[model samples]
Target chain A: MKIRKINPAGQREPPAERPIKRRATKIHYGMSEIVITIVLVILALVIIIPLVVPLLFSFKTQLEFAYHPWALPKAIRWTNFIEAWKAVRIDQGLLNTLVVCFGSIICTIPPAILAGYVFARYKSRVTEILFYAILIGYFVPVQMVLVPLYRMEVSLKMNDTLYGLFLPMAAFGIPFWTLIFRSFFKSIPREMAESASIDGAGHWRTFFSIMLPLARPATVLAIIQVFMGAWNDYLLSLILLSDQNKFTMQLRVASFLNSYGTDRMPRYAAAVIISALPTLILYLIGHRWIIKGMLSGAIKE
Target chain B: MNVFKRKAVLRTEPAKRKKKDPGRKVFVFLCVLPAILFLAVFLYYPIEETFRLSTMKTTGLSNEVFVGTDNYEKLFRDEEFLAGLRHVFSWAFWSIIIQLPLSFFIAFSLTYYSNKLTKPLQAIFYLPNVLPSAITAMLGKFVFAPNYGLIVSLGKALGWKWLASIDFLGNPDLAFWSVFAVATWAYSGFYVIYLMSRIEQIPKDLREAAELDGASMWCYARKIVLPELNYPLRILAILCTVGSLKLFDLPNMMTMGGPGNATVTLGITLYRHGFINWNYGKAAAIGVVIFVLSLVFTILQFSLGRKEDETI
Candidate 1:
């Protein structure tokens, strides 16, 4: 956490030597900076074009896009949005999405907290072994488990139900959630728990009343992340819920695109936008926490 | 105190002297049992099944015979399977070549620009990571249509037919790059965000010291920042390597390894064999191959990652 002072220009680092040669090289480079800038700008365009163009095209009349492929729509076509929404039964699918998101969170987060507590608070070797055994699940590809999960669901008569999607989603997410919560819990000073213990509070009382309150920030971040994951998931919903009525938004969008054909491309675009709205809103509100959470998990290494 | 202790001793029952709390034990069990059961049924069980299926031969509606290592043998001889492996390697090769450096450059710019434009620029770049791969691929498909793509327009103006001259996803030589491009676009942002975080963590003293010594921007960048980014770069290399080996979505979504198996990767090949063709045994064999490859690379990754951490 301590700060250090280092100058960018005057450092003894080998890279500092290039400044004198930089000007001469620039002249020799012959408008190379401009070219490079243009090239990078184009590359940026290429990367962003797909995300932007369709969004624009989805608003224009197909005829307009055909006539002027690069121009903005002369008129805003609100109907395209509605048509796509209705075509996908966005209403029902949104409800289904909400259910899966909240349901999975409901099923997973508490267990993650409890498991995390055990892993954090206990010293038994069995706990460590059990925790690693669970961690192995995170490495296996979802495809590898899909067929077996499907078969099991069928046998259990849970197929095509919200619970079917909820169970697997929750199961897959627990390892990550548990890891996050454990890390959070580990960061909390044990003195707090000891103090509570000395005060004659039960372990459960200390955990719920003291430690849980301390973990609120991490808990909020976890819930948002787990919700986004469950909400945006496609392959699980694709395999589990065969019925249209039961489909989550992602599967519904795929089905809508397939059935509607390309003529209604605008509507498909609208459907895609609608499908992504919850995530977009979630990101806008909690973008800081999401990025920080991801960095904490991935880049801390 | 002696009198009080005597009274307490008299009141203490022998039955309660050795009482132990069962609550914590029950709590541990309750917390872990569901996850264990889930993994056993869902992950480990399927893996065991895949291993079993790899060694078996089936002929009838309900027939399976043990045939040790035969599926793996067939896998090597299958030209298509080998082609898939080659395909995956090529895609990974191109993605690493283009995406890694590009991500670093973007990260560098985001960190170094250090001006009014930084936050908005970083946010703009982070957009692709949140959007699902499905949407990203679909958008890539839209932009790559020769007549519609901006590149096609530029090519037309330049009197070049690069857009129409090459079938992006149809040609064997070109489809790999097409899928790789999409992969790069989607993942480069992720790496950029990753590296930017690391860059931010680099002690400012290094930069200040370099600056005090009259280090040019380029010098400071090449010597100071790049060295600092070494750990993440190594991580990115391992991640991209294994990720490309197990590459599935972009290829599957954009090309479906298509225009005649041009972009078919190990993952797509596994799916095509196991799920599509109902060749469960062969698919399982391919799964075993992928699993082996991933395991070896992952172990290597962990070691390298560990060493990098130790140095840091």
Candidate 2:
């Protein structure tokens, strides 16, 4: 049976005694918080300025932005929305992005959970060797795999297909996601599994009926992380599928920039705002959860 | 009554004596089979292929020749490749020089002085981290739009012709820094969020204690907070290092490594030689080098992570 380490705050064997010399060092932390805060605010402005500037400009006319680049728009260029939409065909790109995201989520998450559970519970030399081998997969840069993968897809006649992109993306996301899931699963109390076993549940029954339900938080996190990754991806889509019709939103949006015309800037403006919307919405809903997950992982380590 | 107890005890013996089930073991293996198989095919196979192709030559006409070590030799001597290496280091230098400690400062500000006003301010700062890189790149393009661009308008009016006279994207000397600035703009928020998350993990007692002791803010930060954040700071450094080396998209979009390859990174080089130039052999060599570089750095990162884990 695995033993759980008592957390630092929970250790109560002895009264917390302070060393005299260390007390002086403790005095420095509060003043530091102020300094840290000031530094953070200034840095935030530096980052925010560039991001906010273009967004502010998106609402202005070309003439307005050129002449008063830093000023607020005279009035919102509401027309730019429809114009960017038509110019970039953002609706179609969003549709494609959605399809790719859901498709890969379906492909990626369940297997990761099942695999993570077994690795965490089964505990054997073979499993240990296999888990390390899976990690080696993350070492190969995405760029190196592009050509051979493209060749492999073409030969298999899966080129220019959504399935083509979906499978590879799912495959690539597995290694890192699996690592996260495995570590998380390992942290769950085995007593929970023991109780399920005592109830006469078999491995499969315990996994599907009890363990999967309990692992929902991590699973949701995995889904969102993979969704974000698949959404932002440009290189894989650019290389794998040649047909413009098959383009993911990222590729489509980027291509809009190169579209030859005097109206390119407005189109560019629309494409960027449109492409960022789903992510923004996702962030609004899932922001707190994602941040919580990251902090728990980072700090606990 | 004695016979009944004996019969019960006898029945329990068989249940206890039942052999370990090979069937159950196989079932467990099957459960993990899909993940293992996928990694082998998608990941393990391609890595092997890169190493294999590095030794072979692919002519445009479809001939493959075995030319061992010649590719690596050629790379060392290739002026263009050397220039690309220089660009990557310089890119990394400028980015880390500005962005790393800058993130620490932002994180400190957002956490320390954060009120209703600054809380929203922090969120606004992190907005870029959520947006897709493609959008960030496009936004950068909007701001850098030559004569009518934001920087240009501000510059010429202020009599800063050097900024106006030099084409930001077209000039070799300025191209790299311009790209660096935009990349910094896009990513500094991400690092801030990362580091800030770590800083928040620190306990509240330490903060209260420091405040009561009349410790100046700078001393508290330098002594207490920065030490605790040291691990994240290290990880961020390694991530930025690898990122700068393999930087593909920003330079591609902004300069196309233009003004004659002044801004080309190893990633750009591999893409150009392999995809655009169709010199598959040379591209494979570049890929191999990149693969090795990525592997080495990843190992370094994990080792550092492991060391921190041990200390804690």
Candidate 3:
């Protein structure tokens, strides 16, 4: 039995509460530090300007935008945002994207979690092959399946519907989450299930009451990752869903901007902003969870 | 011989089944059923269909005419597809060299520099990745747009008339690199956070312990941090390569694989063939090649990752 190192809040225990380690603290108010800070600040400003440039242009008039390299807008153009919102039909797109996110999570998460538990606990030749077989799906590029999926969806009369888009999105999500959850379930001690069984709890009873609750963090991580995947997806939604009314934020925004005939610069900027702002705000509020979920699943358990 | 083999399997299976509950098979079946349904119906079936499509002349207006391996022959002879493949390798190469090291350097600086600035600076750098790539590409376009763009306007202000006159995205070769530079800028922040967090995961006391042992900061980093980071760096490198292989949205939205196919990735090639040209057979052939290449990468990733696990 592997002992679980239950480290709470990621804090390591102090090394005998040591003293006289000024050298280890490593530099205070030095020239190198100042140089590093100046260099990094400049680098940060330059790198951040891509996202910031759109926001700046979204405010500027066409004439003003053409002339200014870097300037505060002479007058803020809320009209630009307004026009972008109408042009992209972002309100509808937002509604559809939320449906995709939740719809995908619902379609995939429960089944993946159940499948993950069995794969983690059971040992057999058949299960091992099944596990790797399902994992192979995760490796396929969406491009590989595009033509056939289109044909399949149309034949089933599932094309141009919200469920049609989300179902396939969930199909891809299931393999990935199954991998994450299996790793998580493996970290759990088998003794919990064994004891429950000893106390006459059936497999279903032990799983539902005990194992499921224990996997709350992993489940939330899977939810956030799946939600983000569905949120940021452009290709699948672009191809599979044709109705303008049902377009996801990415599809609508990309189609609006990528119209080859004209460059609607200010509106393009605004539409891009409208498309991205909510998620950036959400990311700000939830960075800890997002980072933890993203890295912790694939890299570490 | 088959009956004897069955008898051997049955004899071993019964011994292994002695402690198994009657409900075990049912429970396992319930757990596995949904995944099997999805993997089979959606993913695996579609893959097979892609292979089947590759052997035909599919237009959907007419019946798919079986062309055997002729489509594959045409694709191999196609210069555009080969160029796209070269572009993918180049993109992956640049990402691993330029982007990975940039992430590593900044992460090193941030961790060693000061305590107060790390959080805010990290947040600002990480802001790029939060938005969609469609937005990232569009934003990148305005910055590099000719005549009245960011680079040119700044150049004109600085009295560099040649820089202002240059059209970064209009030229074929330049367009590819400009998009590459933009991607590296947008994505480096993500890996910076990855590296920094990995650095942060090393216990505080361990650093102090190294210091107590008379090791300098550089010595500690080289000895402790670098070795610890080796595997994760390898994994991130593979991910970057895989991501480059799937390069679609950024190049697609930014350049539209334009100025005569300068920035066309395998993905863009596939998309154009299927949707734009209305030729699904050639597209599916490209898809099979991509699928094979990525499977190679995935298997490499798994084997490398598993090798580390064995050591642990």
Candidate 4:
């Protein structure tokens, strides 16, 4: 009877262990796994080729591009970039874009941090309503406000100026950034605030000294998102700023495309690359943070 | 008298705490005041103005005589405006049909079967998203150029003679699809990353348990993974719809909504009406329509999704 019981128990153990081993092995090198890997590689190539093609085309002359559109450049044409720079006046555009991006960031971050702290910590009916009211700003499309905004800018004599762009961009950025900041602040323990208050620090003092320092991750996330948005903005810049000299990189690139009309492929390619260089470099360095910030809104538990 | 005294003491204690922190209310107000004021001016004021302007007849931004519903009437009758609405729906439809599935596939593959190549591949997929929309538009223009474009060259190499003369952006029927294709290519990477992040959050032990139960990959994904992803997917659907309504830059840059209003989305139409034709009133009407449509669609989607959840 002992032998019989042992045999049945031992048989059950091996069966359970066998299936897990089988599953482990199947996950590692099955035919389905191989097929999925191959498919993923193909999909990766599809995405990579489009991006890399433009970069490669930027280095070739128009003649080389026309003759061998798929091949790498035989001789690099560095002047393509120079001509593109002159044609688009990208130096001016880049400077304007940088100013707008940084200025808007400066305008947006502090207000967001302050407002977010208040909304996150303070509990009241009025504050709750006000928080939702601010969130309504997120749903308002830029299209809905473009006409009136243009009029407002013109009447205020803010049209065609970088500061003009900065104000609206910063204003529009507030709702989303505030939401991110509020969520981050909420994650901190209430005791932190209570201790500060007990130690004789006021709201602003505690916020500036302690809370703000703890909010580095959210701040980094906000800065990256806001900078990218301001940098890549095309519609507002196009409508609000009429002056050729004040065009952002996107606006300059659009007008350049219209005038260049696809004839100067190499030059246009170079212009595209140059316009995207700053954001691309930033993205390469801070992609993880950017992705985290972006997914925060959708993935909140 | 004793019960009354106890109640009095309780009320007084809380009142005393409130009196001690009287500065907190003022401080909160000061903290939120700037953002509230800024949003009120730039965002809320303009939205209110757009609604007000939509009801009036105006040559430009000023001299509004309220001709109620005239602009809305004109908008419905306008062929370009109607076409713009149709194009936006189609764009949204195609985005849901094409972009969502493709992104899900790529994201699922990367998350489930991660290898050394996953990081580099993820970066490459997201490259288009980081690039300026103008550059993305330009790349589309290059790829579809009839003369020396990659598509044409590849077609020739494959001996597909019909593609040599195809003007993808210039043709009316093709212009809309071409812009849609470019948008899908440019934006899918963003969704891939989004879904991948969500998928990554699923507990490894659960997945292992499913595997140990001898669950097929499809069974595991369908039974376990997809249910967890339902909420994020719903959010994604709403974003995709709203985003499609706001499609402007690519169509504006590539075809300029050309070949007879083929690719003109609501945003492009509003832009042209306001800035190009200087018809502020008509533009405002279109803006109202876009807003209403987006709001209605979001409500409908939520209701529909809720019903599905209830049934499940």
Candidate 5:
């Protein structure tokens, strides 16, 4: 057996004609790689310490927290959670948050899907104008409407009611959800809709039977985004629901801080953790979908 | 045979399409009407009401006399409102100058120098984003508490006696920066994920080719990565601007815009005027200003983005 070689002019030469030498490329880990990795590790630690330290403080007694603020608890005090839970009315807040989240989701999703489906499938001058009209809703800052909304709520006798918050929350949620659902619906092949029409299915029938079932991912994305928005909302709940009994988790935590004072560091820490736990759990499970939704929403034209 | 048959079918389809169904059009309109009505009631109506209120003087909710631009003039002259605007600009400055770069660096490092630990590290970095802003603000308050705060303890451990009793949130000079720091901590993770997605879109082969040509990492980043990220960076810049202008929750929760309104933002000012002071007209004026400012910025961003696209 003989090895072949190529000449500079691109002609093949016989093995007997000449011998060639090849240099092996070596891969090495240099100082730059080490420096970059170390820098990244430091950055990661900076982000993690802030999140984890508060949890550790939550387990300590007030004295323990004061004495060794940076140390892990020598003995975990589960009573801190109980104390914080009662002081902050975590049970009521949690219940209100759940109700608001569910109400907003139920109110927002169906209308958003219907509107999105229509926008995606139907084309006309009216639909185009209506679509842009709704898109403008995306840029309207909540501050611009807060005063009027308050007045409206007062006049309508909807202030301090869960349903009052639900209506506006669902309304604010529509623009984003409609945009997401519209894009998702547009991605579905038109052939499905045409075939459904050929089969004599009405618009609602086609949407319910074909489009909604295929929009599972978008639905999940919408639910997660809207649930987090409504659950974590602070300013709206603060202004709208002044009744302590109707307070959401965010308002409860804020009120706890104001009333409980800063001396009770451990209890405050516990309250903070409890307030954030649901969102944390949701993110841990559905982070991929959350990131996907965020990126798609941001980058989409 | 298939082509001939499709031609015959295509010729007959247009004749059948001549009969348009008004019922289908009406059904489509009905499907979209609910959303339109919701927006009109909840969104557009309030905006129009804000504009109307801004032009009037309200004693209570009912008594209104058109005052022309008096409220707007008062907004510019009001010291606290001016301070709120200044603080928001400062927040935007820090966000654009510091937070954006920090997030970009983390994202770039994670993508280019990733190893087995990268995935877990990304999740950890983004942990703050998943938590409630209110919780994060509370956590920030605890971290900067005068006596037992993590910062105070760290300073004491490092033999810095001056930090032993420094009040971060109570000092007028330090309150705004303190709240700004917490805002950065809570939200920078969002941008990290955003920039990471953009960086991921850059072609892998391009980077590899540059490396094979003996281009240094700095050269590769400057020549290939930065240019590729141009559009997302622009979008992120606009988002950062609009988002900072709307800053409310963290400052409201952490400091209540306290220490003499040091951390007050436009949103906080609106909240104060309407809810606390019961000056609906003044608050409506502030609301109008914020809306106009955000709209102007958005329009500028779009036009700038279009120009860049054309130039490229």
Candidate 6:
């Protein structure tokens, strides 16, 4: 990779320029900058309000909710969280959700990394076709396979099982993540693997020892992303896992809210918060990684 | 891409390694085989099955008779499905025009201007994208609760008397747009996160140099950053288009495609035919069409985007 020097005009290419150069570090704050800052604040509020409103409402009593959703709760209530847990059987839902999230991650990541390495390193005609064959799956909408997926699940007697829920999700994810890992692997120089081979390391040794450790960033990005995705899944869970015991966090929360609208407004809000908690905490912790990963699959290496 | 390098490597390889080549090929096959097998069974075969099943009238995934293209023929004339297509286009229209630019601005605001609040602001904006669409849809119900939503309650509280409870989901006229608003809130942050991250990867020195050279933020964003973000933007557009076509969780869970099928999308329509009515043939037909539409649309967007890049 060659680094292109920024020409005198501050563009990547060497080009004719017109701007007058001034010293760096003294940023002039103008009216538009202030306006954009306000706009940014407003936009942040637009997002924060909806998310935070539920957190506030989760503590509001019925009368308070009816009277003033805008005002603060007089007292913080842990009972609302407990009630939300019971309303949705959120404990079970959480367990099921975690199982699906991690189970799918378990089922998906190892294969993606392995295949991605092979696809990137060992180029051949068959693998080339195989690579594109899997890549094609990325574009096929899930709805296209819905009817058959259900039929297949039923025939396999995997319906109403957690495995049924996550396995297909895993299968669907394999192609996209494989594509991501493939690109990530491609970016690493072949010389590393070649040198390792020349030192009498087998292909597996080179992959596991050298290449795999080097791919930690992509791996973390994929795990967090795939975890979030599995966490948010509803359409598949709704179709396959019909039993209440088998319900995912999404299904439970949605059903709870539907069953008892805002009648128990606080409880409903509590349920919303509880369901949103994991991803929120995850985002707050690993947002930098999440954002990078979100773009990882989209950007060309 | 490197013609001489590839030839040189090939020429330098020893014949003695041929003994190990067969084993290495086998190792490579073993590595990639899982992904190939999974996609074949789960995606490609199901796609082929969908096409086959679409041409057959079936009940309960069994007891079927061949009915060549009848399902598709009926789909073309089916009023509700056509309405669903119209709804999809409208959804795509709003998503591309409104959601795309709003995300761009949010990303632009976060990236172009350096501030202490940038990370936290970006984090908050990105939260909606991480939340399940189901949860967001439920929130939409709460937001437009008519009887209890702030719009009505606050109207009552302040004694301003005329904020008539707008039936956002109940009214046939407003269901689509109401859902669109929810979709915007839920999905706009998604693109912004990607755009912001992608934009941040733009060399900071280039930006600093431009700024010091008296190039305003707007001019830098327009002339330099936009071109750099060309690939991601193109992807976001395709995603928005395909996403609109396959939309399910929010509208379906919230409205059940009602206000009398007024907000029905292709996805909801497929769900209705397959799961609700057990009209597998028709459902599969819808599926086939949806798949083809996404494929065609994706290819079209990719080509158009490539053309734009060439011009750039």
TM-score of chain A of each: 0.78, 0.77, 0.85, 0.85, 0.83, 0.84
Could you give the TM-score of chain B for each candidate, in order? Answer: 0.87, 0.89, 0.88, 0.89, 0.91, 0.87
What tens-digit string does per-residue lDDT give for candidate 5 at B1-312?
999999999997885465336567877888888888889988999999999999988887689999999999999999889998998887887898988888988898888877897787778777788677778887888788777677877887677989877899999999988888887888888889888988987879998788667577778878998888887777778888888788899998888899888888999999999999999999999999898888877776767667665322
- TM-score, every prediction: 0.83, 0.86, 0.89, 0.91, 0.90, 0.89
How far off is residue B75 in model 3, in Å?
A: 1.4
Measured with C-alpha atoms, the lDDT of residue A71 in candidate 4 is 81
Against the true structure, candidate 3 reaches a TM-score of 0.89
- Residue A13 deviation, candidate 5, in Å? 15
Worst 10 residues of 3 chain B by lDDT: B14-23
User: lDDT by residue for model 6 over A1-301, one digit each (tens)?
Assistant: 0123434555463323322121222335456678898998997887777677788788988887777776899998788889788787867888999999999999889889988888888788988988888878778888999988888888889899999988889889998888778878888988998889889888788889999999998898889878888998988898898889999988887788668776677777787777777667877887777777776654531
List the lowest-lDDT window of 10 residues for candidate 6 chain A: A16-25
lDDT of 2 by residue, B156-194 (tens): 668799776656776788788788878887778777777
Q: Residues A1-301, candidate 4, lDDT per residue (tens digit)? A: 2333567555444345556766676765577778988888887777666656667778888778777766878887799999888887877888899999999999898988898998999878878988998888766778889999999988999999999999999889888778778878988999998899788887778898999999987788778778888878988898888898898888888888888866677776787677667667788898877776666644531
The weakest ten consecutive residues by lDDT in model 4 chain B span: B303-312
Docking class of 4: medium
Summarize candidate 3's per-residue lDDT along A35-99 as a digit string, tens digits: 77898999899877766777877887777776774688888769888888887777788889999
lDDT per residue for candidate 4 within B9-101, as digits (tens), equals 999899758755778888888999989988998999999999999998887455789999999999989999999989888888878888988
Candidate 6, true inter-chain contacts retained? 0.72
Residue B19 miss distance in model 6 (angstroms): 3.4
Candidate 1's C-alpha runs over 4 A off are A1-47, A59-61, A78-92, A256-281, B1-21, B58-63, B146-166, B308-312
What's the ranking of the predictions by DockQ, best on top?
Answer: 4, 5, 6, 3, 2, 1
| lDDT per residue as tens, model 5, A1-301 | 1223333565666655243322222222355667888888887887777666768888998888777777879987898899888888877888998899899989898889999988888888888998999888877888889999999998998989998998888888888678778878888999998898778787778888998899987787678777777877877788899998898878888888788766777887787777667777888897777776666656652
The per-residue C-alpha lDDT of model 1 at residue B25 equals 74
Instruction: Quantify all predictions' global Cα lDDT against the true fold.
Output: 0.72, 0.73, 0.82, 0.82, 0.82, 0.82
Candidates 1 onward: DockQ, in order: 0.29, 0.36, 0.49, 0.57, 0.55, 0.53
Off by over 4 Å in 3: A1-29, A260-264, B1-20, B203-206, B209-219, B310-312
Q: Rank the candidates by TM-score, best first.
A: 4, 5, 3, 6, 2, 1
